[model samples]
Structure formats: structure tokens, C-alpha cells
Target: MLVSRQTTVHPVAAPPLQVELADAPPPGVWMNSPQGSAGTIGGVGLRLLQALSAAASIAVMASTGVFPSFSAFSYLIAAASLQCLWSLAPAFVYIYALLVKRSLLNLRAMFIFSVGDWITGTLTLSAACASAGVTIVIDNDRKICAGNLCARFMTAIGMAFISWFALAPSFLFNFVLVVTTFASLLAP
Candidate 1:
């Protein structure tokens, strides 16, 4: 006599489910998020304006041929130089991002942009103020204001102010991004 054996089969277990964080932003949201005037075209425009104004400031001051006479003028030159570089590098990145239809508003990038803009803006403002005060003092002395030298100094100061103004919006936008990102991360 032959005996037959019965086999039992066990069911397989399902994979665990993935639970996304409730506070996490949706994918691509940062890409299309509002950045005030720091959006693609706006960012490029602002950066270009900043770069142009800063360069113009430097050119005007240098054209005076006597900028070396005052320490304030030297400081203005250094500040404007920094502002020009800061604005130009971002302008190029904005241009590339625009052409590629990509967003450059990542957390790390925005933080860096915010800090850089703040530092550059502060330098520009301080330099402009110092230069303006020096120019005013020089203008009051008829002996120093004999020519158009003071006028040129005034023009350069104006350009430095303009550059600072152009940078304001970008700094605010990036600063907001950094703050909000951190806030969200810390929130329950």
C-alpha cells in the first residue's frame, strides 16, 4: 500500500507602506514658488541692474583721477567692486537657469544668496554714506570744489545707492526663503 502526503502553503507578506511627512512640501513646489521679485526674469533684471550700477559707480569714481585722495573713496571702490562681482555671478546663474527653464531656489542656494546679498548691500550702503559725507565736506570748501570733481563724486555715490536699492528685493526674497524653510523644519 502506498501513502500520499499533503503539503500546506503559506501566504506571503506585503511590503510596508511609505508614510510621507505631513509638513513636507510637494515636489516641484519650490520650483514654481513665488520669490517676490526674485523670480526668473525679475531676478535676472535685478541682478543686471545691480551689476551695472555698481560698475558705473566704480567707473565714475575712478574717472575723477583723484579718488586716491580720500580713504572713503577707496572704501567705496572696494565695496562697489564686491557688489559688482556678487551681482554679476548671480546674474549669470539666473540667465542660465532661465535658459534651461530650471529653478535655482534651493534651500542651500537661497541661504547663501541671502547672506551674500546682505553683506554686499550693507557694504554698499555704508560706502555710499561715507563717500557722500566726504564729498559734502569737500564741496563746502570752494578750494576743493573748484572743478567738477565733487560732481563726479556725487554721481558715483548715486550709483552706489542705486545698486543697493536693486539688491534689496533679492535679499528679502532669499531671506524669506531661508527663514520659512527653517521654520517649517522646526515645526511639529
Candidate 2:
């Protein structure tokens, strides 16, 4: 009688930091990949936000439920939902990105961000729609947009106002500083 033998397996070794660096072309920067771009919202915070937004969207969308007869408003709701989702993605990305890095936050900037969120809430959604599932609101009719209902144009304006007056100055100042610093690095 003969018995079969199994070969042993070994774990692969991590690339040496020096070897990894040597493969770079110019501007020898370590960790240049966007792998670290992930926002560090702890599990609890992430879950809470997801639950809250989900509940709010469902309540609002269903409250304005569309039948074949209520087609206009149905399309409107669909458009608004889409836009809100679009805006939230990048807005949340940058916001949490900064927070995770322990970046300094100004009150004015935060206020602007909130306003921007409101404004974007009106956009990134049903710019216009004829179908029930569509929610982007792009209609110019005053009757439809009464008091920022269903993604008003004023919502976009409010976002701009909040961003410029509230958050722009801080972000601009930081951007300029970074540009100047980088320029100095390349100086001959």
C-alpha cells in the first residue's frame, strides 16, 4: 500500500519598500495610489447615516406616491431622488476625507457645506421627467417649485451662496497655499 503526500504551502512575501520606490518614474513620492482615498467613517456612523437617509427617502418618495394619473409629480420625485443621491456621493467623499485626515474645520465652512447640501438637494435630481421613476427637477415653473419643493433652481443658488460665503474662503486659502508650496518644490 502507498500513501499520497501533500506539498506544504507558504505565504507570499510583501514587496520591499525600497524596491517599490525604485519602480517610480519622477516625483519620488511614497504611497501615491488613491487606495487611501477611502473615508474613515467608523462602522456605527456609517450605519446610522445609511439608515437615516434610507428612511427619509422612502418616506418622502412614497408619501408622494405616483399613480398612472399622478404622472407629473411621480416623475418629479424620481428626478429629485436621483439628483440627491448624485450630490451626496462626492460631497460626503470630500467631507469625510477631510475629517479622517484630522483636517481643521471652520464653522463658516461647515455652514456653507450644509447650505451646499440643501442646494444640491434641489439639483442632481429630476431636472425634468415624464415617467414615474424619474425624479430630477429642471422645470422653471414657479408653481412646481414653491418653497424649494422638488429640486428648485433656487436650491442650486442657495448651494452656491452657502458654498461661497461659508466654505469657499477656507478651501480657496488652503488650495492657494498648497499650490505655492508645490511651486517652491519645483523651483530651480
Question: Best candidate per lDDT, number?
Answer: 1
Task: Give candidate 2's error at residue 96 in angstroms.
Answer: 3.1
Candidate 2 to truth, TM: 0.27
Off by over 4 Å in 2: 1-58, 100-188
lDDT at position 18, candidate 1: 91
Candidate 2 has an lDDT of: 0.39
Tens digit of per-residue lDDT, candidate 1, span 1-188: 99986687788999999998754555745635554334478888889999999999999999998999899999999999999999999888888876866667678888889999999999999999999999988888545775788899999999999999999999988898889888888999
Taking all chains together, each candidate's TM-score versus the true structure is 0.82, 0.27
Q: Alpha carbon lDDT of residue 169, candidate 2?
A: 33
Q: Pick the candidate with the highest TM-score.
A: 1
Task: Return model 1's CA RMSD, one decimal.
Answer: 6.1
